[model samples]
Target: MNKRQILQLVILIIVILAGIRFYIYIDVLRSGGDAGVKTGIVEGFLPISALMSLKKFLLTGIYDYIHPAGLTLLIFFLIISIIFKKSFCSHICPVGFVSETLSHIGLKQRINKYLFHTLTILKYGLLAFFVYIILINLTVSAIESFLNAPYNIIADAKMLQFFTDPSRTTVIVLAVILLLTLISKNVWCRVLCPYGALFGLVSVFSPFKVKRSEENCTGCRKCTAACPNDIQVHTKSRIDTPECFGCFDCVNARNCDDCLKVTSGMNHKLLPYVIAVLLTLTVAGAMTAGLWKSTVTNQEYRRHLNVIDKLSH
Candidate 1:
């Protein structure tokens, strides 16, 4: 398969993995492994843990920041953007995968494209209404409920039961997103996902962009045609537009199928992962060191008590 097809398959796998992981975690917790999470590691390198701590942020507003999922997700996204600008959304995002696949089969008709574009604006509106405004006014309980309500009650707890319930709206929404992806194209990500909105906002700052090399341009318009996100690749001077998802389909250097010769390069920055790795290491080290020190001190105190009892005897 071509790069695009390969990327699509990868995205499908990631989505499936994420769903399964969440499911398994919930089941494991229910099986009474609640206090058995092995989060601490040597020098603070958590192979499977999130970059930052969102579990605390989600479970309680106090925000101790244990195993932050959201912040780590954002950091990981930055690394991906650095390698290939917005490629995560274009190539990996489950929602994007759904939409692109659907575009090929279900939304191939002209009317489908028009309808998809028109309705996409609703996603933006929903973000503005629900996330920016409503979430702040409500309590954490309310926020959790809303987040999990569509799937199950979020109340900051594991949600396996929600998935088990076929009648639940949470399952329905996920089903709808998947169904629409096969039928429509990235309908959820493009139009409704507040998380995408958040990422898009930061992605505006992405440095590595797809640019058109004017000299090499025998603009046959294949790039424009091949672009799933519908970017005008031939004429645009700045290829790093917000909508551009860093899928390098137009470049001639990487592959021959490219419509025009494009000079795709990075900004002054290399991989966004550089910064994230450093930050993650620092935080992870600090957490490990701090916890380890405390554990050692407690053990020493216990030893001292035993010595004192032996001396008294």
Candidate 2:
């Protein structure tokens, strides 16, 4: 009905559309693989082909960004994240953001804010574990299985097909984690998402983070209470906590504007640099997968010796 309400509605609409797109991708995969023409089967974002081909990128660090549907979207949003400090997670990450908005609305006046705040830290731990595995045991073939996953009953899945059935390990893990998110607050962004971790790292350099003019301290601690993420706002020198998701809720509060300014930290803030890194990864990753898919077709290896024999003759 007012300014805040209108802004909330706009954000809700954008986030909902993003969620619709993501959910549709999953359904298209589960629909016995017949994905109709409207499904963006050939389009870059809906194609689901890049994940399988990510093997090449994980192995050698190269990629193609023009073909697979997710490459462009991920890179595009990732770039925006560079300028905005994980704005995608706050503004567009459909599922996670939707849940956060709902929970914050109901709990704004609750007495147990600390309980929800502590619970969200779990996401950071989970995110760390995923990265540890990636750094230590990341195998291209194994990850390929997750992204391209083959279907048992359907033969038309253009997405990569691993043994015609996924291992179910990741599926179970993600399912349980999502169930936790439904019951808990911001479990994914707070703990489980590697993307969030990447943003957290870059956010350290975000010039426009919540800044407090110590001179204007009212000591109300309301900003801290208003923070859905539970950042310690009343007494922190630098508000560069890993938990800060750049949502701007604290700074936008009615009483907290002058106290907290989104000050610029650098002429070339960490935001741009992080965006560049993620974009590089997304683009390079896509290109690497595409080239591998084209050149290393299992058929090419099979024909290798046959061509060599002809050359010897």
Candidate 3:
């Protein structure tokens, strides 16, 4: 495997381990046993809670105690996007790794460029709706109310339950997405993930970008063909598109090294490692600051778990 794939695999394994630990912790709680530790890694899945927490933090300067890691991770991802242009999707996201793997199966097909572009709008629309609901519509009181709600307190457990015991509708939707991804490359990341849409929007201001040297170009179109995001790399001297994942597939595809390069003195091969280090440091910093773990007591978790099914958003 390449460096990028290796990094992604390592991250996926770590996340899986964390998920398993989290499941055992929750299962112990459900059985009225003392689950000594609670893993906060699952908080990464609670983006909506993180968004609400972000709003509260901005307004009052008080960080979320219930799921502080969620907000920390959300902020980390945004900062990463601003500097690295969606490197998280290419190098860290488990879902993105799964989608990439699925894309290698079956007959790889490409949707018409026009239709693909049209479908890409769906993610942006979903992001806009979320932005409106969380950032614009909700008042500070409403945000605080939701953040402290019983349902929100146990959202991580709920999310685990969602996958461990998925509803028929959820199963069907996931199956369809998987099937689509098998036929077409990165269908979910390219067209439907609101998280990716958010990152792509923020990445527009990133200083680093792919630069093509026309003088050194052979017009082989290998760079364009190698782009998983369907970005037309050969036709443009500079790729400033938000959709660019900074995967450097195009750069590696070039016949000549100088034909394709990243701007701002960044080495393409070292970029993924840089991202991995930054992610590690970010999580470490949060842990040092006592912000990586939830402040909710084990007793509180047990109390919430007892009525978890009765809680609603």
Candidate 4:
């Protein structure tokens, strides 16, 4: 495995461990025991809540007390995209890691180009819908109300329950996604993830990008073939497309020296380590600021769990 893949594997393992710990923490609460473990890392999955909390924070000066870690992580990811060109998707996101792994084991079939482009719009549409609802439509008061509601307070627990006791529809939908990923590369990320779409948009302004030098061009298409996002790296002098993941697959695939280089960005060799250090610092800073954990107590979690089935948006 390459450095990027190594980083992804490490992050994926950490995420899995965090998930297990969170599950145990919630299980202890469900069993009327005080686990006293802080599993706020799972709040990374609660993006919608984080969005609402972010809006509220911008409108008012208050940070989300219930899921502070969610807001912190959302900000951290956005910043990473601004600086690193969607490296979070290729390096840190567990979903993207799973999608990448499935692509290796699966058929790796190619969809029609026209169909692929058409489906790519779906993720943008989802992102637009979310921006309309959370950023444009919701008033500060509405956001505040939602953030303070019992439904939002225990959103993390609800998310855990979702996987632990998935409905038939959830199972079917996930099965379809798994099948799709097995056949195609990054099916969810490329075609259906609003979070990735959001990052792609932000990454358009990123100073970092892939630059190709024609001086040493051998006209080989290895880089294009290596691109997981299917970006035609051989055709473009500069890859400014938001689809570029900056995972350095294309860079690593190049046979010609200096043919394709990441321009105006950290060196390809050190980018993964830089990302790792930044991630560590981000978490450490949040912890030092007392924003890495939620203010919700175990008793509150138990109380919310008792009535979570009846709660709705």
Candidate 5:
């Protein structure tokens, strides 16, 4: 199968895994006691805690116990961004899959160029603000306090409830975003996701890129039309845009035999296979190293779930 189809399958697998994790939590809640299964991978939704843990790790060399999985997941994605150019977003992110699916419901309508630029900048601005807040305010003690807070201990439960029992404001915001995405391809990923912006910045340093052969000499602009980020692919000999997701749609769009390809010193059609192997090994290594799960125990989760139950009601 082609890369796009492979990416869709990957997304489906991830979504299923996430669903199973959420099911474990819900089962525990329904049992009113230990159901004997807990999945820390769900903590990946807690990006704020991950950022705090990352800061603590940098300053003190202490790996975060409170949300170890979140921190590790964040690190894994950053590594992918460095090596594979934001493949996490294009190939693995469940939310990105949802956005892409929604955006494909109809033909995409273009927004004003000025408005599009402003919206694109908003994500970077949000990333900058978050970085500033985390860097300026974070300390070892602060991290400890935040991690140990009752609210944080029950955060996963709350996150689940946030979707299953969303507030009116949450419903409205999500509806608006979904509507926007239906009209424009990847409105959230391209214009409003801080995580995407973070990966975009890191991907700037990646050696891998889509390089065009100038001598091939066809400027059909098919690549530009296929680009979700609206990058001008036909004009450039090399695509160095941090906005590039390395989705390979541009390369695939070109009918010319040698006009375009994703390369790093050499062309390898099995690059996706290499990336998949690397990703699988990294996750497996992290699990075997005992860094995949959080330090929180079933007893702690039981107590935390009680608190979450109380808070929700």
Candidate 6:
């Protein structure tokens, strides 16, 4: 199969795994049992806690037990970005998959050029704000306090509530975003997601890059037109744009095999296979090494949920 097809399959597997994990967690929560199995991957959604854990690790030299899996997954993705140029977005993230699927339903029109240029900086701005808040405002003590807060303890439950019991405003906002996604390609990832911005920053240093062959003599601009990120692939010998999610749309530009390739001192054709093998190994190794599950017990989780329930009432 082609790289794009292989990537789609990978995305599907991830989405299914995530769905099953969340289903089991929510079911266990509903059953009111301390013995219910929980999925630690759900903690990945709690980025705030992961950031606090990162700070705590830096300051105390202690690994995060509160949400170990989340922090590990975050680090894993960051490393992948450094090695593969944000393949996590194009190959693994469920949100990105959904966005890509929705983008297909819309007219293949670009966002307005002027507005797109202005809005593209917003994700970076959001990333900067997060950096300032986490690095500047949080001391070791502050990080400890926040990570151990009741709200933090029950954050997974709270996230479930956000979806299972969404308020009118939440529903409306989601609907609007959905509608907008059906009209624009990757609006959220391109303009709003700070996570993507962080990955993009790390991806700039990636050795793996799309290199255009100057000697091939094809300036057809198909690569540029095919790029979801709208990178000027025809004009540059090497695409170093941080916005690139390594989708390889440029390289996949039909009949341009010799004209474009992704490389990093190795065979570019093995890129997809390498990504798949690395991703599988990372996840499996983390699990076998006992870094894929939280230390927080089911009893502790249930107790925290009860407290949150009482507070809400």
Please rank every candidate by lDDT, starting with the best. 3, 4, 5, 6, 2, 1
| Pairs with steric clashes in candidate 1 | 52-68, 53-67, 53-68, 54-68, 98-181, 99-185, 99-186, 123-191, 150-170, 151-170
Task: Give me the overall lDDT of model 4.
Answer: 0.86
**In candidate 5, which residue ranges exceed 4 Å CA deviation?**
266-268, 309-313
Clashes of 3: 0
lDDT of all predictions: 0.48, 0.50, 0.88, 0.86, 0.78, 0.77
Residues 142-209, model 1: lDDT tens digits = 54443332121111122223344545778778777777665544566666765555456556666556
Report the C-alpha lDDT of model 5 over 1-313, residue by residue, as the tens digit.
4664476578578756876777776676667755665676687788888888888898889888877778888998888889878777777777877777776674657666467767798899999998987878666797778888868877877887888789999999999988888777788998889989999999988877988998994888888888766778888999987778878778777869789877776444565676677767876887788777777777777777765756531
Using Cα atoms with residue i matched to residue i, what is each candidate's TM-score against the true structure?
0.58, 0.56, 0.97, 0.96, 0.90, 0.89
Off by over 4 Å in 1: 1-25, 28-67, 78-84, 105-107, 112-115, 134-162, 168-183, 213-219, 235-237, 252-313
Model 4 C-alpha lDDT per residue in residues 239-270, reported as the tens digit of each score:
99878787879988997878988877366788
Q: Which scores better on TM-score, 2 or 3?
A: 3
The number of clashing residue pairs in each candidate reads 10, 17, 0, 0, 0, 0
Alpha-carbon deviation at 174 in model 1, angstroms? 5.3
**TM-score: the better of candidates 2 and 5:** 5
Q: Model 6, 1-313: lDDT tens per residue?
A: 4575467666677656865677667567657744455677677788778877887887788877777878887888888899888877876776777777777777776668568768979989988998898977878888887877778877877877787789999999888878767777778888888999889999998887998898993788999877766678888888888889887877777355788878777665566677778767876888898877777777777778766765431
Task: Tell me the tens digit of each residue's lDDT in model 2 across 117-178.
Answer: 66656656765665566545657666554443222101122222222244588568766755
Model 1 residue 113 CA deviation (Å) reads: 4.7
**How well is each residue in 99-149 modelled by candidate 3, as lDDT tens digits?**
887776646566677788889999999999999999999999999999988
lDDT: the better of candidates 1 and 6: 6
**Candidate 5 overall lDDT versus native:** 0.78
